[model samples]
Target: MNIIQIDRHSGQTSSQILAKAMDLHASGDLHEAEKEYLAVIARGYRVTEILPLLAGIATINGDLQVALDRWTTFLDLKPSHLFGLMEKGALLHRLGRWQEAVVSLQAAERIDPNNPDLLLNLGIALIDAGRGHEAVTVLKRVADIRPGNPLVAHQIRRISSAIVPFWHIPMLNDQPRNDAFEEGIKQAIAAHGSTARVLDIGAGSGLLSMMAARAGAQNIVCCESVGIIAEVAKKIISANGYADQIKLVPKNSKDLMVGENLDKRADILVSEILSSDLLSESVLSTFEDAIDRLVHEEATIVPRAITALGCLIESDVLAKYAFVDEVSGFDVAAFTELAPTRLPVHGKLTSWRRLSDTHDLVHIDLRARKHEASYRQVDLPVTADGIAMGIMQWIRVDVAEGVEFSNPPDHYSDGGWLQVVHTFSRPISVKAGDQFALIAGHDRTSLILMPAG
Candidate 1:
């Protein structure tokens, strides 16, 4: 055979070019080493081995883009290179290209599914990509492989707590609320028979669905929007032996399909979507959608109506949380404009003086098929000579014909639903006979509370 010259112009063989490149790279002469490596690649000599060497050299010089290019070239020749995919993903994460990082890491994870380092990077990339719920799956794999790993456990907890609302845990412990809802479901099941299809819009922990199953209902479907919570519900439901009777759908009530998700429109509907101010969680839109699509013409809605009960109150402790005038001797009253109009206050822990008798501020008939953004002027009659802060509101649910539940400020404490302080723009001094002409209504999702001209 004729002697092979990889670089005819330099009269050097392929082995000689690679040997010089390796020596220069080892001696920390990256500039000269890269030139030799490029010559080797140009001469079509050992490109597969030289590309990774070039990439490592570029990395050493902090040339991330060039390193990434070398890695891409190397991967193009060998797409199944797991470490190449991982290195590319890590660089993308550092560059803040989160979604792309997730894509790359996921590819590596498919090859070496048991590598903790690989799975951890994938989970982190998924979280940075704003897909934390999806990250839970990856982290769970790591969790299983590396049992008792506090870091993996902590990551799972962080995502779980972030996605699940704080109110859900407390709401589950609210005996009065739970009892009322359970009683209503029992009544509905009794009326429509045990086999009637019961639908729970916000099936947190699968509580209501299991309650329906326990109350002799044969069929129940519950929907939860939070994916993590939905996973928890599946475990809880399965553990409680209601897996056959209850079908949990991981979706918002608005997204639930009538024909597919549910065999037909439900015969009974129940949901606990009310926030502190009553409408902040889009209860109106949720209920309206449930009526128009999810339920039958005369579906036995568990909470047939929701009433927002409130009273004018004055409290020094409560005012600071809302309207801040002088702070550290600075008149930053303008900051009060950005203050939250309502606060979820613990009824038992907070102190306040009622300046007016309790009144029914807004009444919602949940059975209605539709609702409009309603606002009207109202006169809130005062009973004492004190500053009018705003309204201390709570929810009163008409669960059934003879069953009802409420968390009034005075009578309710440490319940799932806390009393809300609906504050005004500023403190208004008023006499005992004074009346506040204020506008109150639902803006479809949030409550409107403001002074009327």
Candidate 2:
């Protein structure tokens, strides 16, 4: 087909040029349509209407930057234009400019707060920008407006997976953990008196704070780093009738101030920030900071001590995930180095056989003012003859003096704490009577597990 060349000498009107541009755009001749649209804009003919069409054509032509520029220009003319803002924001998101997209979508959200489409886009931008907590909040609003929307629910789940671990729900329902923490709170109140000021760090669902309040603690401060979790904790604390007694601080424990955030240092400190691998949640630094800046010299610490316990394991199922050698007759053992060092495994769901008796790998004193990373070598007597895949590790929490909780893989079925598999570089074969030397410790934020040479 030949190009439809417009003759400037024929006195073509702006309306005529716009009609030709629309016809070319409808016929899928975007290049010609863009030229005609530009001519129409130059003549100042229906600039607002033609600009969006030109932008759409640019988008269709695979010129995203051009499309973004066109939409930006249209927005300048009509700052309050709803669709203009939406297009600009959406374009920015496609271009991988997440923060810019968030800014634009936020403006659109301000214009129409109840619009589900705007909220959905804004939530996506927030997630892309590594703001999953904020995304969850925005997406929850979307769910409220459009009930039973599967996409909203799916997005919420996706964001939740990234922000919160899978074990939190089960942990919340763990009767033993709850009972242990409650007992510890009661003991703390008994020792420090009911009026003692309490500090709860990593206040997930505000369960510990409510426990303290129920134990007759008059003043309590709880801090949660995740904003969404903190908001939900507020609701839970309020619903449980402890809102007045418990103060919710939506910031990290490291940021809490003694005089400004709290009237004085707390008399009792309680926290449930322990991870499956013990130190993954920065519990060491958090507790150390609390002891330094947020707690008194003799503050009663719940879970006064924690220990990382583990046993050697052997499993074909776990081996498939941890180490891979050959695939389709090709040696890919090198790929095993790229595998995750630590894997969260459901205690009851995963199949594995213990090859050695459980032993304490590391111990942490919660009352200590400072901590340094340390490693130690220990020998474990093998109880079974099998190929060693890794060590399955769990945590033992000594909450107060008498209350204690341990998530051993054999008896602990349902809880937030999943047993972690610390995989070795390669599988080792051993006999029942063999003794295995192992190195274990922590680097403040993660557990270190390896076989000793």
Candidate 3:
């Protein structure tokens, strides 16, 4: 009876300590709350729940190390505890331990597969770990589940952007990205002459607007969304003696107002907003919004349309860029799991083969009277004999009157953007007269190509 009394007394004391901790925590006295929580934990009371609260307080107070320790303790006591697992994973991510975070979050996901938050966190963790392609797979799921979530959408854009190979930037400069604009500008000028009111979205280096001005445009409003780049563009416009003819708006394509930024609706719309893979920069939405809200209905859009070109190609050269196979007589296959990336790829530098000769992917008609979402299954006929590596993509621009340009596969050569070759897992061998079906669409920020029937 005496031993029972002692046990009851101990339980009462533990309960009292937990109550005090809860009260303090509820009152926002986290430091005092922490003390009480520790006291309850020391007394062996509700370790799972109390430890998470302690970890939460620590996390909120910016004591990350303490939070990590507390979360670890909670997980040890309750390994499959969903909240505890997520807290620990998030903490690991905060500490830049991306791989560890992915494992933890993935475990948590296995425990609770329907949790969108867990999936989003896992995607973020994967991205931080440098597994961009993998991250895209996870993030795309999140996007489908939470269509209006900007953050999830942003992550999708980020991952889609990274799928491009890196070596193409220098090569892009050598291509005709700028020259295409120049030709388009001259055409727009000849069509409208000096009387044309021009709007240039994404005015990189202010080159397109200056080209417009040189082609004799008056009342040219050039909007560059990047501040630093806009500043440089402003200087370039001044240097090129077209500053008086051009007005620069240092804001995003969406931030510009029709009346506030321009006296009248633009007669000609000029923009160099095409990224390597076409939609990586949300050119579809930007053009749609600009056209619907900012520009006139009949406004001539430079690069009136852009065709997103893609093809199945094979490359032994691209192996190193996309995968880590053999390294110094060691097979570090596990390390490939930690690979990081978040940008488009250029196929020019990588050793690859055109399994099925280049094919056109989806094309966004920027000059359409109305913009709408659409998708179609495309059957690409293989006209060449080669191993199909993956989709090689580029943009073919219909700049202006009689000015047609293409970032041909032979050249990842262009300015500001390069043609991206998205490699597949394994090469698909094909010969002349072979055909493969693929589903292709533009989701505002990404051009998706998936295998179809």
Candidate 4:
């Protein structure tokens, strides 16, 4: 049997008030319990102990603001209070004050560095604060401490996917593309000799820089904009015994300074920033900036030209992904407007029938001082009778003199480059021997493909 607590209005000892507060809290009379706890604080008795209890009660009552204030007061009294800092950080995180939560959690981390709970909270706060690179670094430590923790592994994967594209590893494994770039790099080094300075703009994996080093280039500069990837590249370069010959610049090539970062303009410029669609990686602007500011006037550019090649395609699977006319017996053709204009599809993975012969859509000269957007309309004679989905596009790289690489759908497989399908506004039924007019061009950074009426 339980008895109701009696109210003493005046001259109660602080301990008596605290005992009554705990009794009220235990009885689920939170409102009165909060008043009794405040009375204890007012009487200046065991405030540090009472504040945490009050804060926990406030949190349970959905009074987050009051809880935050109580925790803040407790921290003021005991600045290095570990549990106070942890609770404050967790509260700030719930309140969406991510940076403040990170600060508080990090302070707690310094006090208890090996605590997995503190590290997990800090990682989440860093992620919500848009500091994904740092979050991954912190979460990796958590993974080490709690090995095979699915939550930690899941967080690390989610952050990695958000930060890097899936094709990066496959691109590194692309032998043909790697060989072509290596050949161009070696040829350039043969011509320029060991004194030539080689600049690799997007040194993904530092492969090209290592190639240059192996080819007797004494000076090589590799730049990768992503911080985590740059750190990985540094490790790989060091492991390959080229750390002394190659210097890694963990910044965008645009941010590089001439006299401070480089002794002189590079004699050879190498970059593989080309996307599956040829220009989606901002290759034009990046290359233009390099030519104008980062390289010698006569610098030998690897992949001196890139051409966009495309063919009309018809695929039931592609049509399903690109268009919608009816769904569950509902006339949802209007929903087709929301379909993606361009979708990357693996040439070997996706099944599509070619409706027309492959043709050159557009070509970019890497060494040109400047580029202007241009469009052209071409007539393609359809060779097959089918429903037209859109143009399936690929890339051909002229990587230096006598070195070329093309990812045409017919022959190329298991490479980093995937064909991009430019979806039409609507599906069109076509017959063999019909001439189809198609519009193709670029908007400086992306290739444009459209059906011409």
The 0-to-1 C-alpha lDDT of every candidate, in the order given, reads 0.88, 0.91, 0.76, 0.92
Model 2, range 1-453, lDDT digits (tens) per residue? 999988672788888888898899899888988899999898787999999998998888789999999999999999988899999999999999999999999988889999999999999999999989989999999999999999999999888877876677898999999999999999999999988999999998999999999989999999999887888899999999998999999999999898888999999999999988899878889999999999999899998999999999998998988899989999999999998898889878988999999999999998999989989997899999999989999999999887889999998887778899999999999889998999998888888899998
Judged by lDDT, which candidate is best?
Answer: 4
**Each model's TM-score, in the order given?**
0.91, 0.90, 0.58, 0.91
TM-score of 1: 0.91
Rank ordering of all candidates by TM-score, starting from the highest? 4, 1, 2, 3
Error of 3 at 328 (Å): 12
58-107: candidate 4 lDDT, tens digit per residue: 99988898899999999999999999999999999999999999999999
Across residues 34-53, which tens digit of lDDT does each residue of candidate 3 receive?
Answer: 88888778778788778778
Q: Point out the worst 10-residue segment of candidate 4 by lDDT.
A: 4-13
User: In candidate 3, what residue range of length 10 has the lowest lDDT sum?
Assistant: 163-172
Alpha-carbon runs more than 4 Å astray in model 1 = 1-18, 27-45, 327-330
> What ranking of all candidate models by lDDT puts the best one first?
4, 2, 1, 3
List model 1 lDDT by residue over 296-408, tens digit each: 99889988999888888899998988888888999999999999888889877898989888877788899988888898877888889998787888889999988999998
**Error of model 4, residue 73, in angstroms:** 4.8
* Candidate 1 collision pairs: none
Q: What is the lDDT of residue 161 in candidate 1?
A: 82
